[model samples]
Target: MAVSPAPSSGHLPRTSPRSPWDAPPGGAPDPWTPWAGPEALRRQDPELADVLLAELRRQRQDLQLIAAENFTSPAVLAALGSPLANKYAEGYPGARHHGGCEVVDLAERLAVDRATALFGAEHANVQPHSGSSAVLAAYAALLRPGDTVLAMALAQGGHLTHGSPANFSGRWFDFVGYGVDPVTGLIDHDRVRALALAHRPKAIVCGSISYPRHPDYAAFREIADEVDAYLIADAAHPIGLVAGGVAPSPVPYADVVCATTHKVLRGPRGGLVMCPAELAGRMDRAVFPFTQGGAQMHTVAAKAVALGEAATPAFAAYTRQVVANARALAGELSQLGLTVATGGTDTHLITADPAPLGVDGPAARRRCAAAGIVLDVCAVPAPDRPGGCVKGIRLGTAAVTTQGMTEPEMGRIAALLAAALREDAGTRAEVAELTGEFQPYP
Candidate 1:
């Protein structure tokens, strides 16, 4: 095997063999290639192959501004598509229920170690299937069924896992919902503290899906301390930024931090949980036997790759650009007659009301879809007497930044968004023209 020198940047460069594979010294068969012929899959299953390829085309041709999404590196994709997917590792690295787990064990260990290092946590579990799964495990480890917990209200920019009436958390636990300040679109620490004292929750959860500003971990810790509650930080949206050192880490303050690998982390679509050493055992067990079954070894390996990439200087630089691009885009949105939540952003996420531009969030989302501008619709905190009534659009810079877009591109995107919201004809062509310069796959 040839060992080429590492690239100048942290990102692993993708490699492809020539059309003809080289013969071995003993004239042995050629090694397996990363990619099979394009027709190989189509021949077997044309319908599914078309769906997959069409998805690829859609991703490559549109602006991916969804805050919960990002483009994974080719190296990470390679890991996801590797033979490790065949393994059924059911437990942690050292202990497994299945045989032939030795190799996959090392992959899991690598993922755990890299995750801990990336976010400066004492312990990490990289096996949970998704961010929601990670949070479920965190709750399982810390609280019993029916224990009173405080979490952001779902209508107030909180995630579904955070006390949604439709989720397990809402059903199994006695949850007290908190909301952001009606005027500022930011969390009101005073109100949260009051709620904590009033409810005396067993745990206080701090995190959100659409909130644009960074959470005050220390403040939440203090409030939780006063109430004798475990503090759980659902950092699914900001973990990638935290890894890049562009955002504050919750590992130090929250008893357990739950995150997703995909968002800004630019890894596989998986979940990660980090905590202090004392809680490691419970967190692991919760993820393994309690919430989920066999671990997806391939996703674990991809997470390891992503965590390593995140620790690199280049990834840090990329995260910084992600934030900068978000701030610039928020300004552009504000100038284009949109009411930007918090007036601007401190992270890769931006929440704005397109109602000022003659379309509500859902309408704007439909229009943006027609224009091939990918983003999400979210519930915004009512900027008046806070009960959650306003609907708005949410955008993230991670995906576009991953495509090598910058502030100027953000302005163009915001312009395109405005034109689309206004129902201008021929806006999708402009969007296609812009996206053509930044193909996510190419």
Candidate 2:
């Protein structure tokens, strides 16, 4: 395998490879040729393909720690590039707004049915363009405008769609938020119950983007029942683990569940909504016409392919390994004097308070990027109590673990992170060397 160039310190550009679709030196077929979509740049400026190819190579070679990013299988990628992309199949199967969509509709229906089976939901809608779109549809189905909603506070490991003031969910409806217990960095179910009783929200949305533990969907159900509110589980991050029976599933407790097919599911970028039988019609209506039109049939096909994979025993083992890897990484980080949230993780992500290490989330993310590891900058909010600081940086083991990384890899990654924070040049070189051609799950 060939190695990509190393990222330089202090001035590393955001790394991305444009394409990996070309045949290698021996003229053999490129392994990734099937999924490499039409090169928008290659068609317009042929010379740019080299740069894009370099970027793609860098991504494969580097350590991907982004909580929401991963490498999809070639099978799923092939489906994404299929002829389904050309179809404009509006409406459900056998009820399309466009003709010549028979095969496309079948492909999409397969995706919906497979997703329903995978999650054990009564109905599934695989059309929302992204996780945020899927979430909006769920909200639209369950709440009227201005209805009060209870969701996890963003600064405390919640998603933007859950009720961030700057997001559409907060703008369109009245939103109240609950947070993790500051001392333990874990969600306080008692606090959630208190808030639900006080607010009597239309829906209690449960899930997070940076949280380090499995959400208690059953508990959220109890809270919602007490308040006569609906339970919406946005299991976008842990859906794969849930499906593999490694994490507690929300299907039994949630009236509506939303997820993205990427991340741990390892599929093409797309979203899905799974609801109980009672909300089938409303959820469908919310997803269509209300949120979007003309579903991306290609992506839906890819989603079906991925969902099929998720049902396999291998995928189950893969999901378990991801959580195990996360635990290993968290333990190592904690040993390195970083404050890992919740002490450790029950899922594939972990959060650390970088303030004690003399850095902020954005700066830490950039430093990791420069050292050939990628991460997202997370928000930390003000507290009712005084003398609080930002929550810090978040990381995940999904991508690296998928690349066949184990405890040793986790330790190396953690050490690289510490060195990056300390501005140690030797550690960055070691990271680049260790990460060469490290494709997860290939």
Candidate 3:
């Protein structure tokens, strides 16, 4: 393994011109400390400190391509670790069920207001524990149990929570799924329309976890209108892009939109639900005293800080770069003779169905891991098809591109993937050396 010098850390370089894999001071203290534990407790657990330090270093070394992950900013991290974590604000701002929640209520209210401005929604609920939980709350607010719901097919780029048999959406409601066109690998509006007419669902989910193409929310709205269904746009993957005005905003087309604060929003690891003011109270009630108890004030504060950042000009530029980086990565991968799902991506995530490359998702992900390129396997439909064994692999450019990777980096990444897949040990060694060439996340 040839060792190369490290590049500058993305924003604020943590270490000097030294190895990022080095251990942190105080023998690996809890990264989420000063809040999660007492000072005495942290002092008593030095071994646990070592483990966390190693974990952070490991995370820095690997390129996280998983679409669901991101590098939260230190500002947001600081808010999450602040004293707000100790407060137990059990209700909405200015109307809390508990006392001494003035600051905490302010934090939560700020998050709500920021989210509203970011998405231009009539109302925003920044309280759900996560994106899925937000969606669950939306369901509770809009439809009754056993109401028919239409969503995208999981194998064709839908989320498990959308209607997968394993998820709560499926367990509670009658589900009818719509998939993309087989020949074009894109969402088929006509097909979705047909499903809507047949099912007459109470709701239709309009976003996906693995979709590489931009959704036509207007068309989806038409379908929902045809069946009197509420369109819930799960913009978890592209909310940041939409917020930054780089992608289509679902808030206008869908009756409600649910998204995670982290993914593209680059906020705290939480969820947001946006809807008309008429439905806002129902959504809030569904989230609090209905689904969850007290809100996570610290997380809410972090979410507020992140939403503020997203409202800035810099975050828009970052979102734009994320799209550009994804397209570059897809084009470069295609050059490597790898078939990217739908030929490429319209969002941040690229789905590469490696059937033509003579590999399955698990094998390719394993190879990618060995080469220091983190990738994940997606569920592929039709196990009997030539390249169809739930073996699809999905990668995104949000994190690495945010780290400042450009076209040149994409080119290098594609070459590394090709070499790793080919099992060329010598070439693999050369590729491994390149990992150190870039600055690991600080």
Candidate 4:
């Protein structure tokens, strides 16, 4: 057969049409194209897609006041769903067990670099699957089984992983608990020192889940030094604030800092551990071979994106607004006859005992949910009562701040909460109108 005698130098003879896997005339795919979303899920499983869409609608239509919640960016969401999720990188960046970790190594490295930069820490391990896991890893790194640990009381704004009787920490360690002052509803430094001096715990943890004020990390460090204990700051709720420079950082004071990426950081649901450079190896070992297996590379990539976002000036403004909105909400609640814990909030959350409004915490939360305002029931500083008693409602402004609400909007939300607690007939309509004005995902 006569071959095409001579194909032109610039233009070769075409053999076949382009396949779906082939790139376009350009070198790479278009980045702006909508790659994955509800439509893709709908195509695969319509029922699950509907549920997700309904959840999106619910989030858009209702207020989210859960203290440990926030709305992440679309970029972070994209990172969470990226192809990196397909990989299984079982160890730290260069030392991973798997063969195809070059790209995942870059992802994890970027996450670690960004986290360390954001927090001004010596080292970072962005591997733990959740905040609780981060705390577990920190414990594993610092303490041995049956070692004494002094942590805040769970009923007084402390987290379960800090040493609740039902948790692994409590079961494995000899945990001595401290509480905030019943009168101030804030941590009592004297009491903490007393307990630390008395128990001489191996580790002293200072942080809270529902606390509404800035923690005295300096004092905690002093106490820890006096007792020769390792100080751990479980800053799950305030990492974004610390990164933005609007709140005090525990990195300089604590031996190790544990945090969740999603809560205030507004990233994917993941965890981070930052510590002094000297302890980096121990922390990494604890997180990988001890607490968890293969790191979630996708979430680590999302965390890198969030840390990048948080380092910008715009995120600083957002964090400042979050604190302002929280203060405004607490003031409004007090004006509307609610007893705000600590009189008001210095952070992004307001813990209020609704008893002054003639409603229990659970009842107030239910009423607010019915009126399209979401929050969580919390325990107050009631030493006489059991830990399960619903004594307060904890509300946060992180999600609302992400929705672009301000001080004026906080006032309106407080009014809605007040009216809802009282069962006013028009409160639900007001909530619907307000939520329509500020869509969370829009």
Query: Number of clashes in every candidate structure?
Result: 0, 6, 2, 0
Q: What is the lDDT of residue 35 in candidate 1?
A: 39
Predicted structure 3: clash tally:
2
Two-way lDDT contest, 3 vs 4, winner? 4
| Alpha-carbon shift of residue 59 in model 1 (angstroms) | 0.8
Better of 1 and 2 by lDDT: 1
Candidate 1 to truth, TM? 0.92
Candidate No. with top TM-score: 1
Task: Score every model by TM-score.
Answer: 0.92, 0.88, 0.88, 0.91
Q: Write the per-residue lDDT of candidate 3 for residues 130-214, one digit (tens) a residue.
A: 9889899988989898999999877777788878778888899988878877767788899999889887999999988888888
> What is the lDDT ranking, best to worst?
1, 4, 2, 3
Name the lDDT value of residue 264 in candidate 2: 91
Cα lDDT for residue 71, candidate 3: 81
lDDT of 1 by residue, 1-442 (tens): 2336546543235466533333345634333333342444565567998999999999988878899899999889889877688898888777899998888888888888888777779999999999999999999998899999999988888788888789999899998889887778789999999999999999999999988999999999999999899999999999899989999999899999999999999999989999999998998889889999999999999999999999999999999999999999999999999999888999999998887888888999999999999889998766563455578899999999999899999999999999999889999999999989998888
TM-score of model 2 relative to the true fold?
Answer: 0.88
Each prediction's whole-model lDDT (CA): 0.88, 0.82, 0.81, 0.87
